[model samples]
Target: MPLHILDRLNHPLWPAARAIYERSFPPHGRKPEALLRRMLERGQAYVFVLANEDSQARLHPAAAMALAGPGGSGLIVDYLAVDPALRGQGLGSRLLDELERWALERTTASALVIETEAGAGKENEGRRVFWERAGFVAPDGHVHRYIWVPEPYAAMYRPLPGREGGLLPPPSGRQLFRWIEGFHARAYRGFREEE
Candidate 1:
């Protein structure tokens, strides 16, 4: 019940959600707010916020995620954040549960992809483990350099419909470039939409 789906970010809970996002992600991994706002306006993105049941709708979200389906398909979980104070209470997992539900039921995305920083550190390993527990598997290959960061990230994916064909066939070379462009291009597209 705390999972509140947002049509746009200009809502009472935005400050809380923004604060959590800022705190959860490092500077380089976070997207520009302007870019996210524009994406919402163009109907290319979806947002969901989680507020503690006791806090109700007035307080900022305890967790939040911003997922985008570029070109009317291909789910990209661009951001997922939980309030540092509220971490380890299973709130993050709950948020992901809601996110996956939306993508699988409300949208037609064939696969859900999450790009994670590649590393050998425990923190990085822990992050991957969390996703793995949720049925996500890191595909074999380097996805790309983070848009703002200089390191290579892995494109981990989970086929949402829960079958072999639910996956996006792995891409290579020119196909990989096109695959990456498909989602990144939408981020740069103008946000104009008819009323």
Candidate 2:
């Protein structure tokens, strides 16, 4: 199915997007709908949905991702989920690739960041594998926890297509450790008041 992506979580798309989001994230994991709208109004949020582009009617949402782009950069993968029935079809990876492309083409983002549950536990093992297979790099000894999320998570990054396949500031690679923590503290400030 052809996908239809919307930069802002606006009308003619909210319903389907909402369904996917609601199903994908738990209560604390999701911001209030009103908060999402406000973020969109302020240009701090982006929602992309895998829609049936062929139809004019409200398209069905197969997969969706919500991003928080602070300062119009440091694109954070707030949440990503595929329709339960559509899992194992590669839609999630495709959607993520599309989001990466969208961020590169439409914004000034330097990299895409996602916080995934990490550890030897069975719960997070598959999640970790999925991200790694999708081209994300998780550094050793570099991990963090979101304020609202109780579990320890590791940061994964896929730099946007840049010069010589390096970060724009050229500092991330040279100072990878500092960049990860700094980005997390700055990007998730609302949830991490003190970080």
lDDT (10s digit) by residue, model 1, range 1-195: 467766688977677778887888877666677777777777867667876656543554445545555432457777787777666877767877777777778777666667776767888778888888877776665556546567666766666665346444653333333444576677776644331
Name the lDDT of candidate 1: 0.66
Report the C-alpha lDDT of model 2 over 20-103, residue by residue, as the tens digit. 788888877776776666556656566677765545334454455455453323567767888665679888898888877877
TM-scores of all candidate predictions against the true structure? 0.80, 0.76
- lDDT accuracy of residue 63 in candidate 1: 55
> Which numbered prediction scores highest in TM-score against the true structure?
1
The 0-to-1 C-alpha lDDT of every candidate, in the order given, reads 0.66, 0.65
**For model 2, what is the alpha-carbon lDDT of residue 16?**
76
lDDT for model 2, please.
0.65
In candidate 2, which residue ranges exceed 4 Å CA deviation? 7-10, 53-59, 68-73, 163-195
